[model samples]
Target: MQNNFIFFFYLLAFLLYIPTLILGTFLKPPTKKQISPPTPQSILARIKKGSKYTKQALEDFEKLFLNAQSCDQTLWLEIIKEFALSPSLEIKEITSLQEKLKQNNPNLQNEIALTISVAIKERK
Candidate 1:
């Protein structure tokens, strides 16, 4: 009876172990998928894609600038809007660029100076 009990326990252990051994033998380990980084062209394309939205915002700003009754406040508003909507640049960098443009080109028109600053910053 004790021998029979031991046989039953061994049989149960074998039943559990055999399937796992068979599966381990038959199944391949999972491989890591290699993800390629974006090429410069692809990165540029994505930046361009996002720029469409920026362009639309700029167009709206242009319309607002054209129609504004108060140029002083409106120019500031447009500058703020441009900085706000600019793609992915750090705020401090944009601010510094704007300040440098303003200091260097004090005689330039506000809109033109802002346009130059934004163009320079966004390309980075």
Candidate 2:
């Protein structure tokens, strides 16, 4: 009877251990997915989709520019040029928006200047 009891205990242990071992072999650990930062083109596209420079679009652009991620100056210039050339805005409105942009981002002075110059050249 003691031998039978011992056999039952071993059998129960084996049953539990075998299933765990099988599951461990089949299961895999979860992998982390890397999320990429926003691109200048995507931001520009969002701006272009709007009828005018909405507050949300400007905020998004500002966040992208201020982010530590490096982006091409040409793409930034293109976005500024697009903003400057938007038909819905008058010259005064454009200048006002430019001032607002400059005030918010002092580092963008040079790029804003270049964009204005390019817009002038394009207009002529």
Candidate 3:
């Protein structure tokens, strides 16, 4: 009876070890998939250009900004409306704009600047 018990224990151990050995043999690291660092081309690919919305917005933005800078209320409001419908300008310009607006509100200065930026981006 002791011999039978020892045989049972050995058999279980062998069974567990066999699966581990087989899995280790079959499960190998993938050879085809190679991860490479980002190149200039990849970075360039991320950049987007040429859009009607952006073009129009940039034009209006530039116009408004210049108009406001020069204190031209007549042109500023008209340009602001044109850009309001499409405001997909650069983030840096937008941040600067928000800061400008906060610093000086209801003064048409910041509004004109943002409007002109949008217009410029759209053009190119």
For each candidate in the order shown, give its overall lDDT on alpha carbons: 0.54, 0.70, 0.51
For all candidates, the clash counts are 0, 0, 16
Note the residue pairs that clash in candidate 1.
none
**Per-residue lDDT tens digits of candidate 2, residues 31-105?**
999977657787678667765544455566666674323567677777777766655545776677677667765
| All models, RMSD in angstroms | 13.9, 5.6, 12.4
lDDT of residue 16 for candidate 2: 97
lDDT of 1 by residue, 51-124 (tens): 55444444443344333232454454445445444665455655664565456445544764566456655546
Residue runs of model 3 more than 4 Å from their true location after superposition: 28-37, 49-88, 91-124
Query: Ranking under lDDT, best-scoring first?
Result: 2, 1, 3
Model 1 ranges with Cα > 4 A deviation: 27-39, 49-124
lDDT of 3 by residue, 1-124 (tens): 9999999999999999999999999999788978764332222222223233455445444434433444445544444434333335455655464455435545655655666556556645
Model 1 vs. true fold: TM: 0.33
Task: Provide the lowest-lDDT 10-residue window in model 2.
Answer: 61-70
Q: After superposition, how far is residue 8 of candidate 1 from its true place, in Å?
A: 1.5
lDDT leader: 2
The total of clashing pairs for model 2 equals 0
